[model samples]
Target: MKAGDPGDCAGYRIEFESSGPLLRVRVTGAGSYAATVDYWRQILAEVQARKPGGLLLVDELQGPALTAGEWQSLVDGTRQQGLETVRIAHVKPLGLQSVEHCEIYAREVGLEARVFDNETNARLWLRYGGA
Candidate 1:
């Protein structure tokens, strides 16, 4: 349950771990448009290569600071690739509004997405499908 190291960027960490079928991502730092896309591309590449069949956990991210275009691209990429369950966890209170917007966008793109302020709850839902 340790956090990963930050990327070359100033305020971003991308760590990957496995919890059963889920690929857990622990991201810490600012989530701007370019940096967030790069981070996710790297992680998604790994997931695509592995082709795991569980959930994708985006943990401790402080984002949706992305422009609308970036958000659309992210959602489109996920849908096009047909990634497994994707869940986002935002520990800080940075982008609640943006998270809501992203949730709606995700739904429109035919993905089931949710946001969580509590990391524990986020993990639980991702792990158990909110049973």
Candidate 2:
């Protein structure tokens, strides 16, 4: 099911799903740093509680609007929590700089992170265990 719009954060919606150890998150609409963090924290808590061995799939997200600090926080937090993988899917075009930054952060954190133009590919990569 989908998490209702936060209402306070430019109509952002957080959807959660679980398949065995995999946790899926879909964030839609404009969102502030605080809102994004809150959503991720909640999802992470659930993942920890479940103690899953699978990855995290984040879909339909707009990454360019996110500040570098916010991205770093997310990467660090997920890494610290020992989540096996994170795959983010962006519906819109992403700049080369943003892509490079994500790649670097993923490498630093030892998490397989990749940006995909399609949700299907992201899901496949996350499920099949690919960097």
Candidate 3:
């Protein structure tokens, strides 16, 4: 699906494309923590149902930075939602330095996740364990 194809998805515009072993997700909207998590669960559901090799999440949501607690909660929720089995490459939203913290929290909990400033690197990491 295209980015503008959807009107609103749980208060966010989410597009998903599956290519080979990768499930590419693009999320764009003025987002909040709760709404973000809701869409994330939807993405997780798709991943669980499809059983893709990896996930590339391009998050362009504009929102206030999440607190440390919120980041931990997101990571925990992701794990609890059964995404630990797949590698996740999260494209950090512009100006969100807190994404690194999210990656750290995810790694701490044994989630195979990484954060990147651009999609190229993210895709590279997802396809191959390159830095």
Candidate 4:
């Protein structure tokens, strides 16, 4: 969890913490999913441009469930941007069902996304840059 104020993009307030080439994006909260994604698309574009091969750790906690289209958006966005990320650690959304569903979709589409219950494990994966 991030403290203090973060840079706001659309409805999503983000904290960008980096140790050299590794970047971690902590999304604290969002006003709306649609607006958040809209902003995320733009933010991701910038990230892709700025750091192509850097590991990205995205910590999304207690977030709303994502629709199929939303999942597709992530899939398409990563593919379109050709973001060859070293690794992406996504802290699981609240609730087991949501986490399971998200994991299933990720596995099916080869999203290269992993969901974790806490930041500790997620951070470990990001630190190691491997599964």
Candidate 5:
């Protein structure tokens, strides 16, 4: 589905594409804190339900940075997929230093997560499994 495709997926836009063993997820336009949490809950459930491939999260949202509880909720919700050793690559939003904060949190939660300056690099790393 395209980014503009509709399915009552909260206020954010999410699209998933697969390239070999890697999964590319493009996210744009964030919503309120609660809405954002709900969106991730649904999207992660969908992604995990299908296949938990290497995840490339191309976030273009400009919403507020996720709070500690929200981030933990995100980690917890995504973890329900039972994904083991899933390479998580995130494309940092423009001017958002908190993107790195996400990386830190993901790692602390035992997820192999990294932040990239761009989508291309993020996908490449996910495909290659390293720099």
Candidate 6:
């Protein structure tokens, strides 16, 4: 669907658009590990169907940071979904728990993904490799 079409996925609000170079997804609402997994699984289904050039995920979930096990599960799930085939830039506001380990693990799994604190930098990286 184009942007602004919201759907409830595991109690999270997910909106996505595929009309551009990147599939833009915005996620909001309370966060939980199970919800997070379902969120990505939905996104993975979209990616497989749409085949966008890249993905930009703007996350605004309000809750405790994911545990280490949760992060590992996420990374493994993405790898299994063949998410490494497409570039991804995930943005969460600053002051949230850092996701450096997640990024590192994603890279180790061959996923071209990065976590950013803002959307401008995320878009720049998705478009120009951060120039």
| Candidate-wise lDDT, in order | 0.61, 0.57, 0.81, 0.56, 0.67, 0.81
- Candidate 5, residues 1-131, lDDT tens digits: the string is 44324344567777666666666667666555676666566556656655656877777767677676666666766664644557788786565545666677777778888898887777678777764
- Minimal lDDT window, size 10, model 6: 93-102
For candidate 1, write residues 1-131 as lDDT tens digits: 22333355547777777666666666777677777677767666766755555545554556556566667877777766645444443333343545555666777877666766666776677666652
- Cα deviation of 2, candidate 2, in Å: 11
Spell out the clash pairs found in candidate 4. none
- The digit string of per-residue lDDT tens for model 2 on 22-114 reads 666666666556666776676677666766554444534454456576678767777676455444433223333344455567668776566
In model 2, pairs of residues that clash are: none
Better of 3 and 4 by TM-score: 3
Cα TM-score of candidate 3:
0.88
Alpha-carbon RMSD to native, per candidate: 4.1, 4.2, 2.7, 4.5, 3.0, 2.3
* Model 1 root mean square deviation, Cα atoms: 4.1
What is the Cα-based lDDT of residue 36 in candidate 5? 61
Instruction: Kindly report which residue stretches of model 2 are placed more than 4 angstroms away from their true locations once superposed.
Output: 1-11, 61-64, 84-100
Off by over 4 Å in 3: 1-7
Q: lDDT per residue, candidate 6, 5-69, as tens digits?
A: 78887668999887576899889988888878888887898888777888999889877788777
Model 6 residue pairs with clashes: none
Segments in model 1 whose C-alpha atoms lie over 4 Å from true places? 1-11, 59-64, 67-69, 84-97
Q: Please identify which of the two predictions, 4 or 6, would achieve the higher lDDT against the true structure.
A: 6
- Better lDDT candidate (2, 3): 3
Residue lDDT tens for model 4, 1-131: 23223666655667766667666666755534565466456547556655733435454534567676666655555554534444556664444334445455655656555777776877677667575
TM-score-better candidate, 3 vs 5: 3
Q: Which predicted model would earn the best TM-score?
A: 6
